[model samples]
Target: MEPLTEAQRRTLEDLYQRIDERVSPIAGTHAWWPCRKGCDHCCRHLAAPLTITRLEWTYLWEGFQALPPEAQAEIRARVAELEGTQRPYTCPFLDRESGGCRVYAHRPMACRTYGFYVSRGTGNWCHLILGLVEKHGDGDIIWGNQDAMEDTLERLSGSTLSLFEWFATEGC
Candidate 1:
């Protein structure tokens, strides 16, 4: 994979910072409040074929490097197994013991954008929004501008790699 141009890296970082600010407040509200400590329901599912930028890949590599050597080896082994299967896989960054992402700070956009409202289509499929309900119940808060944020991220980055592919190749 090619390295991200310095301009692309700056743009992506800026976009990430802006979205973090905007989403953090709304995420604090009741809609996403159920997402408390140790609730790993969202982490259990196999994620979609998320395409991240090369710069994002580099960032993820940095995070992986910070882990203890044993942890890194364990994760790389898991990733290798998953890659051999050629199917969707859970994030390698997820700590199996703690059920939390070890690289939460540098997690890709798709990881950060989950559990939020997203609208689609002109009728039944349209106006769909979802979020955490509560500590035990559904928070179901909706933010109208998430798509815009996603668009902005894509436009600014100019690079993309699938989440699984990223892990498979990052360590090679």
Candidate 2:
């Protein structure tokens, strides 16, 4: 992953701020939103074998570079382990003790928006969030345009790679 240029960082910050503006208000409004500090359900279930654009990857690398060497090594180890795993892996950035993102500020858009995302399938949301949403039962369901967002990211970045593979090959 390349170092982020100043202009790129500015653009990234603005984009992230826009996302936070939307997600934060809605997330905070739901007092019962099950996405608490220790509840890293989505983080565990939705790890990176998924495609993320090069720009997003570079931004994430910037965050990874900021961590202390020990933390970076630990995260690298986690990423290495995931290289041979099957689908549905855990995020390397997860802090095991804290059960939180190590690079929350610089997490990719996919990481930023993991929730009861509306699926393209008939009357379905993401399965991982099903239990958390069961109690609400579709009363003003917190919808997420994950598909559209992915499309937008792909368009903007213009280069795509599997995140785990990217990590393994690119080196923190």
Candidate 3:
């Protein structure tokens, strides 16, 4: 994939910022939400099959390039281990010491979807994870599901590269 042009990068950043602003209130109001600073459970447990556009992939590749040599090697090793595993692995971009994403500014859509509400569509009931909701408390809010967003991103990007595949193929 080609590198993102400055304009493309700006656009992608704008899109992400908008999404973050729109989704934050919903996520912030959830009850049982243990998503406090230093809590890394979601990053540790969730499988992030990235559905990034080529431009987004380029941005992530840039992030990989910015890391120190040792950190880059570690990330590559982790990616190699996760390449074909059926189970999801922890994100290589997660900073274990900080309990936060090292590539926060360039994180994929899936990373931004946690701690929000997901509608069931059939009137079945909108669901928020109990643990999250209990911690954050329900405030008036609406948001899309992580699964739906992932599907939509995949469709829009016309790409099937999983997170690990993207990392490996992009020379990250």
Candidate 4:
């Protein structure tokens, strides 16, 4: 695959920024976003449903390349377990010892917007936040529109894949 050019990188950055802006409000308003530095529950979930466009995956790969050789080997080694029929597995990029993304700065849109919805679609919001919002009768709960996100991503990279699959198969 061709290295991402400067313009493409900037585009991806802009997209990430948009997602960050969307997440910021929900994170700030909801005291239930217990996603602290060491909280890796979402990343460590079995049957994790991480999804991202090729553009996002490419960015992730870029981050992967920058890690030390030992870290890269460890990431590659985790692929086999992730590919197995096991019910639950941690994300390969997750640093198990620290419970953080090895590629935090370049994490994909899905990772950026996981706890909160980018749109008005409900159901997937954090349970605590959802109940609080409901009890307080504050406003509608809008989750990010994954379909709409795919539409925009398809235009950029023309492909999407599960995050685990990407790690397992190296985005083949």
Tens digits of per-residue lDDT for model 4, 1-172: 5578898899889877877777677567666556567877778874554667777888888888899999988887786656645656678889998888999998887677666654544445455445566676545444566556656767988567787767656633
lDDT of 2 by residue, 105-161 (tens): 778887666663444663333463566568666576557666776676677676777
Model 4 stretches astray by more than 4 angstroms: 46-49, 118-122, 125-143, 163-172
For all predicted structures, in order, the TM-scores are 0.72, 0.83, 0.75, 0.80
- Tell me model 1's lDDT, rounded to 2 decimals: 0.62
Q: Can you rank all candidates by TM-score, best first? A: 2, 4, 3, 1
Candidate 2 overall lDDT versus native:
0.73
RMSD of every prediction: 4.7, 2.5, 3.9, 3.0
lDDT per model vs. reference:
0.62, 0.73, 0.65, 0.72
Judging by lDDT against the true structure, name the best candidate: 2
**Model 2 alpha-carbon miss at residue 80, Å:** 1.4
Clashes of each: 5, 0, 15, 7
Using TM-score as the yardstick, the better of models 1 and 4 is 4
Clashing pairs in 1: 34-134, 52-161, 132-139, 133-138, 133-139
Superior by lDDT: candidate 2 or candidate 3: 2
What stretches of model 1 exceed 4 Å from their correct place? 1-9, 84-88, 117-119, 122-144, 168-170
